[model samples]
Target chain A: MSGIELKNVTKRYKENKFEITALENVSVQVKAGEFVAIVGPSGSGKSTFLSIAGALLKPTEGSIMINNQNITDFDEKQLSSVRLNQIGFILQTANLIPYLTVLDQLLIVKKMQGTVTKEDKAFALELLKDLGLENKEKKYPNECSGGERQRVAIARSFMNDPDIILADEPTSSLDTDRGHEVVQQMAEQVKTRNKAAIMVTHDERMLSYCDRVYRIVDGKLSEEVRTQEV
Target chain B: MGLALKELLYSKGRFIMIGLIIVLISWLVFILSGLGTGLSTLSTGVLSEAEYSGIVLEEGSEFSLSKSSVNRSLTEKVSEQEGVTDTTPMSIFRNSVRKEGAEDAEDKITDIVLIGLEPDSFMEPNIIKGEAWSNSDENQVIADESLENDGYKIGDTVVLDNTDKELTIVGFTENKTLYHQSALYLPMENFQNLRPSSPDDADVEETVSGIVVQGTDVNLETFLEDEENVEYGTKEETIEGIPGYVAENATIMLMLWFLMIISAFILGVFFYVLTNQKTNQFGVLKAIGGSNGFIIRSVISQVFILSLVSILVGIGLTYLTVLALPESMPFYLESNMVIIYSLVLLAISVLSSLFSVAKITKIDPLTALGRAE
Candidate 1:
């Protein structure tokens, strides 16, 4: 099960000229199979919080327990291994390697981890099929539309069968309809797979699709535990 | 593995440009190295394949074969050494020769290095046609094949300039020419009498320009310098003593080595720019669990592939040039030389790629996720 527990996490950017507190004493937990959306305006440190949670950036002080193991004390290699084996990150941009075909994109990540099994290919195909991109596996990122590229990015995120998926502005560049569809697809997948999903977004209109929504303003998070009754 | 290759294939323009740069650089190195070897062979044709281990020249002497000289008595002294199997007197002088019966001759005289060798000398290994020289007044000369190409037959009488002596070409040898001029071989006694040079006022018969000694037991060179007051040298030392051998080789080698360094810098710069452009992707990969070693291996593999392709193309082009070269152009293609040069080129290419690694290793993976255009 992919459950994330953050207790008293704080992060600060200390430069030679100035210091900026990005996240201050932030504590949160998301159960497995939860679709959590982190909403914030610009400079609200939502990216910082999501980055710390994804093990992309280590917190200045805190323990990140994912599936009961504390990841904050892990070394660089260990952290990378954690990210590879246990976490999947999706960014605002699709960030697909232009040179790799859609099928090869997932294959490369798997190859980087060491070897790709027959089952891995089957699961990749199944993921692509679920994302409505089964036909575009041989195409390159440059040949795909924005929405399709996003979907491929999402598919790549789950290629390793990660327990936790962290998405930062996954549909920031898409139209309202495409953004809504991308969020809806991600929500449906998170619930269907029973995997925890934490998304950082500035788009308020997309928050309704998530199981829970939280807002960050001025280095603090304000949680909103509500169900969509519509 | 597949992704790295796919990346290279996708960006045809960038990789091709890099490959083209590699090809052009490698081609330049190959051509220059070939020319350097060709010129070196040309300068040392007579001695490169000689049987003598050493040529005894005067100590502190700059010129060994070309300008160094010793007396006939000195040749006898060199022969007296324990290792001395035999010693032959050789006299070299430059003079123009003209065919005696050429009616259309507008002074059709060609300057040649007349090598007065013994009839039984060990140095005459490549005599292609006709017999060696003999003690005769009828003027017997073994001309290099180049002279034969210039229209001199075995029976053709060549009039030595500044003398009434006319020599008949008795034979021809291949690649025996020194520098750019053809060499003519004659008997020690005849070459002394026939080849046009300033007469030795003192002990004329005993005076000889140099001596080729065969055998290895004794240091005949020390004996030549001390006892006979003559210069001596080993074959390798003699080669270094040849005019323009060391200087020319040093200049060419310096240029080649410098070009290799430049290749490193060029590759370094190319990879630096490339890695800089892909910093964001690198960060994204790093964020998603790509280790630094993985990134490094991928970049290095790309460079290795590029260098390998370029070197192959460069060597192929060099082979074509060497093959297409005119036989008389003095360009020689030695297999050992090719191997050595290619290894050197490859070493330079690999060294050049290190600059890329140096730049890549310094790249902060965190920069990949930071504000990128």
Candidate 2:
């Protein structure tokens, strides 16, 4: 109830009177201290579902609840507030701002929230240290490797202590070993911090790090076998 | 503000390059404006400094003092009219003056404008040194301060062109130049002797070029209508009628405004392209909870900072150029005018950034999720 809940969510796109459904009546609940992975092939609407879950995109008909508050009727400004204070996103391609340093990547969230304090700075530093990027804090995104950039992105997501973490193919650009390490770190953060997480990925190797997995085929979502213990 | 400044610092080369372009454009604008001011003062300084309400010229002279010929009798009639305090006849003509011992050669002649007026009249200049006009002596004259630049001093003898008459400089006054030429003040008798007689006016009495009047209560329209072959206008309008005055000012102003608009367009195009390149980054920021206001503020702050610094640098450079320029150069920049132009540049910069702000507001954060079509 304190995490993210989606009920009968349907997303449809209309282009010149031609309607195409991207999500079809998907119902899922991600609880606190849980790591869920949704896996599907290309064009399976995996990204669309994650986008809707993250509140970046709205569904045509459905109700989304975060912390037991329905957000389906929220305006753009209110939705932005929800995204800012409640949702953390780890996007594909490691979208760290090219102009910011590794430490600034995390601090920007506090700046946006207009609550940057000494404690926030300390927590950002601690988050970088926990992610094993303590020494690379002063380095820009272009100066870091792909894996390092992903780790920095992960640190940025945890900066605000959000209620839910949404990651879309966060490890798609990493090697096997680095990808597995990043997913393991993400899972550890979810369980340790008691935050809910939903990862949309196509890489089957990442499923072993999640408590549960879901498979999406042709805009339909179904629960899969548990690959790891919670 | 921090993010905007950090980005500017991060991309030093690109921002500085754009900033330098602004500096160049601003520098040119400031210099052109200074030149425009200088040329305006040079063209109209004499008329502007006169303590008169109106000038009466002969009809059909197009307000040109050189082409006008007012009968000397009109002065008494104008002075006795209602609300007319005083009326003085004056003559202005361009002539060459040579130092006493100079050979008779064109190269030795210094071009000057000779103004003929009544001694002790309202048109007499306040003498800075030496004595004022004592009588209608044909051999004594007062020279303006600019004559000092040509090495002419009080008591120095100079020969007026076409008269074979030498005159001694008896006094010097300040701010008395006409048409950018040094002025020589002469008595009315000397002016009558030197003024050319028109072949068509063989039977006419002695005529003056124009009449300078004081006191403004008279009806100028009815007065001019009553007198044949006479037209009148305020001193300011008469100054504006000077040849090349309006056109010169207009051309310089047009150039200055064109530069300003082109600078704004350059900034707009630059920021637009920059925002286009960073659309994906903006999308990501929006998805991560950055509001439209925050993004817009950052973009505008960046432009403001860049414009403020670049314009200051350009103004500083212009000041340096002004300081290094020779006294002979006609370049005058007023401090208030500089401030006004700087504010205009800053405003233009903010307006230019609107293009980028619009792009930012329209960016869909969903694009950041990498959702396939």
Best by DockQ: 2
Candidate 2: regions farther than 4 A off = A15-18, A227-230, B48-91, B116-156, B164-176, B185-235, B323-329, B371-373
Q: Specify the CAPRI tier of model 1.
A: medium
- Who wins the lDDT comparison? 2
Look at candidate 2 and give me any clashing residue pairs. Answer: none
Candidate 1 has an fnat equal to 0.50
Backbone clash tally for model 2? 0
Candidate 1 residue-wise lDDT, B186-250, digit = tens = 87777777644455566666666667777765475467446545666777887787777889889
**Chain B vs. true chain B: TM-score per candidate:** 0.80, 0.79
Q: How much lDDT does each candidate structure score? A: 0.78, 0.86
RMSD of each: 3.8, 4.5
Every model's DockQ: 0.52, 0.55
